[model samples]
Target: MLSLVDSGSGTVVGRAEGEDIVLDVHTSGSGPALVLLHGAEGREANDAFIAALAERFTVIAPSHPGFGLSPRPDWCDSVEDLAYLYLEWLERQDWHDTMLVGLQFGGWVAAEMAVRDCSRLGRLTLVDPVGIKVGGREDRDISDVFAISRSELDARHYADPAAGPGDLSQASRDDVLHIARNEEALALYGWEPYLHNPRLQRWLHRIHVPTLVTWGAQDGVVSPDYGRAYADAIPGARFELVGEAGHRAQIEQPDTLAKLIAEHSA
Candidate 1:
């Protein structure tokens, strides 16, 4: 496992390698390893969720390449590339059969990793994963979050916009830059297929490990129907809906989400 020093807030921040790519990772708690993959916005924003999870298990949250302060490798242009990179990182850390959690775009990464190879992963939790064309092009499976304004995007992601991240207009310069980098990275990875892998559904059968799939009841970005479709694709996966929440359950319902994860992992 990667050795980490506390960041003075019950979390440890550090960098680790994934082949040629360097990832900024935060770790806390002390128990079985629990690797967390953040969404397009990066790890900094999920401090509450991370801390809550850290209370029960070791939480290893990593910022995707090109997001936050992490440098993106030239070759890392797709989610598939990210999956392999994470696999390499896991092997280097010698972590096996550990709990794995993914949120939003991170959930897409977790699904890809779980299906590709589950030897290193234990229980798997996917929170509103968006990475497949569930319906025909005429039917909107996922919202065009990239095409919308910041306020609109927030509105779609949270039942109460005030509970979500601060508006970009009111953000600090550093926060704005970080968001720009995150959006650029999201475009590089998910723009073409529009947040999905064409063949992922067909390979869901490969994920035999225990899985929990959760979604926000009021998710406008990707409806609960889409979340149900994802759970149905996986064998023996359980599906749940958190009421009064939208796409970002971790933000709106951290305590409840963390409790679910803790119980499921147990």
Candidate 2:
């Protein structure tokens, strides 16, 4: 069965294996499960939004392969590949009626998973997702985050510059290396499609589960319009905006975002 071990600290730690890949999974709280897919930066420990959600529902956050403590497997080189890996993991766990939440790149992965199958899955939430192109002509789609300086990128990611991961001058060597590694892994999975699956939009209609697409009202990475298009493509999907936040709502406005997620899933 699922070998989850509760550490008495309100968090449970475990590992899952599928397709020759292993995932370091962290879970907390006590009701239904909510699987959180981390963004390109990897997973965070004790994140505010995650803690908030833990109060009402069990939260399960897994680091994408090659992110955080998860090692990358050679066979996993695309977002689609990651999607399949996660699907296999979910099936292996025999989890049912679970809520799935994806943020940024994780959101893209979640979308892919839902499009493939919704069996045993309950609700879906995509936050500041970047998986489909919504730009035309002179307009730009998602911002080229890798193309900008770290400081500038942070500026666009948060409404308050100070709240961002400021200058890394004093950043620990390990922290610096971790950031580099995250970018490299992101490129491995998203470089070819440039962070989007060209055909995902067309396949979105296949998802018949309740879906919520949330965007930070001040998001500069992917505009609110792009988020709206994502919701519109999926029948009956609802799009909501979180104010005073940018790309990372969980970082800027965790509690509020958690409320939005909890209500939608409920």
Candidate 3:
């Protein structure tokens, strides 16, 4: 079932970050540099979510090294490596006054980036972010939970049918299969003994930026316990539970998610 909707207008640029090919994405709307990172699903998975955000901010949403159309570099290993390359992108663009929003793995990217440099960042919001393993205290990593048939995709992504699944853009069968195949590769590269790096957790308290952590109330992917721990780990962080949603809270609850972001940025 193909759903018709308005795709964002933008220019895609292939920029070089050392040996890596970085995609320098520019899109509509105007404001500070709001960088968005998609979860393991793929960058395109969050296009509509980002487009809704692009209306109020100069959104700079990039595909991670391998995901989406961007060329994945060999040197990029840990999510920490990803953080460094993204900072390089900012330096290249000479951008400042930024807000960062991340989903799932992308949220980990935001957490990782904040620990590195919070000086340029104004606000941080994470939707079902995966940076550290919550250990049943609060959140559970979806990488540990997504072992089922393809049909389970709907229930896992969104609880509210009205808002539609996170992948509401309804990708072509071939495209959907192609992206799903790559997610396995992502899981292989990113999944570890633990859902996150122990070393990375130590750096969370160092972030002084005003942070907002959100999770789907029904997020079996990464349990709510994990989400609370994430918020508690960070300095001055507030965690919110987006009810009736699961891993893809923003995609399932875009309006609620957007309002939280707007409030945080404001």
Candidate 4:
């Protein structure tokens, strides 16, 4: 049985496990079920987005193993593993008419899941997702996020770099640790194939659920063109561009992104 405890912060923390793996899940609100998959920056980075989503739907957000306070099992390493794990978790929850939304890395995970089994999902939204290769072997569709300087990364990640996380020197200890953990986990999973699954593009057509792919209009990490390709790969998926935002559209424009998601899922 899954064990949930009150986190005293309006969110309930639950442990969802499959075999030896356990995921730290944060849940809140009440309405139709909406499972949110967070980006490489981890769960805390999407706090505002989650709160906005919670207002309309019961938000079930899980910290991928190795992110936040979740422990990563030795055998679990890739996004594919996370996809299967979350799929099992969804089955265990037995939620119907669920909306699955993925942001950045989490978007990749959600796509992987839907391509495998979308039986319980009613809708899917991928925001600035990175999981498929749409460019030639010599072309780079996604930017090298790690290689870039913090200033450069911020500029690429947020439409208004001034609005990005400023002056890390003032960050709390917990915040620093969370950031470090996120970076480590992201590199571990995305380093080899450079964030795109070699086979995911071939299987995207397997996803038949009503899908929406949203991208930051000014996204430099992965251009809007890449987002278009992502939408085109899935059957009947629509694409939209969130203006005045970069790669992290949910962070840059939570209300706008939330509205788009709410309308689509509704």
lDDT per prediction? 0.84, 0.81, 0.71, 0.86
lDDT of candidate 4 over 1-266, digit per residue (tens): 11222243222222344344555778898888999999887888888989999899999888887777777777779898888888877777777778999999999999999999999899999999999999999999999988988789889999999767766788777777787788888998899799989899999999999999999999989999999999999999999999999999999899999899999987
Q: Give me candidate 3's TM-score against the actual structure.
A: 0.83
Candidate 1: minimum summed lDDT over ten consecutive residues — where? 1-10
Model 3: CA > 4 A from native = 1-20, 24-26, 136-146, 160-171
Worst lDDT run of 10 residues, candidate 4, spans: 1-10
Alpha-carbon lDDT of model 4: 0.86
Using Cα atoms with residue i matched to residue i, what is each candidate's TM-score against the true structure? 0.92, 0.90, 0.83, 0.92
Clashes per model (N, Cα, C within 3 A):
1, 0, 9, 0
Candidate 2 per-residue lDDT, tens place, 86-141, comes to 78778878998789999988999999999998996899999999899878745668
Off-target runs (Cα >4 Å) in candidate 2 are 1-19
Top of the candidates by lDDT: 4
The better candidate by lDDT, 2 or 4, is 4
lDDT of 1 by residue, 1-266 (tens): 22222233222222334334556777799888999999976787788999999999999988887777666667678899888778877877889988999999999999999899999998999998888779997987989988888788888999888876666777777777777778888899999889999999999889988999999998989999999999999999999999888898888888889989988898
What local lDDT does model 4 show for residue 138? Answer: 92
The collision pairs in model 3 are: 138-224, 138-225, 138-226, 139-223, 139-225, 139-226, 140-222, 140-223, 142-221
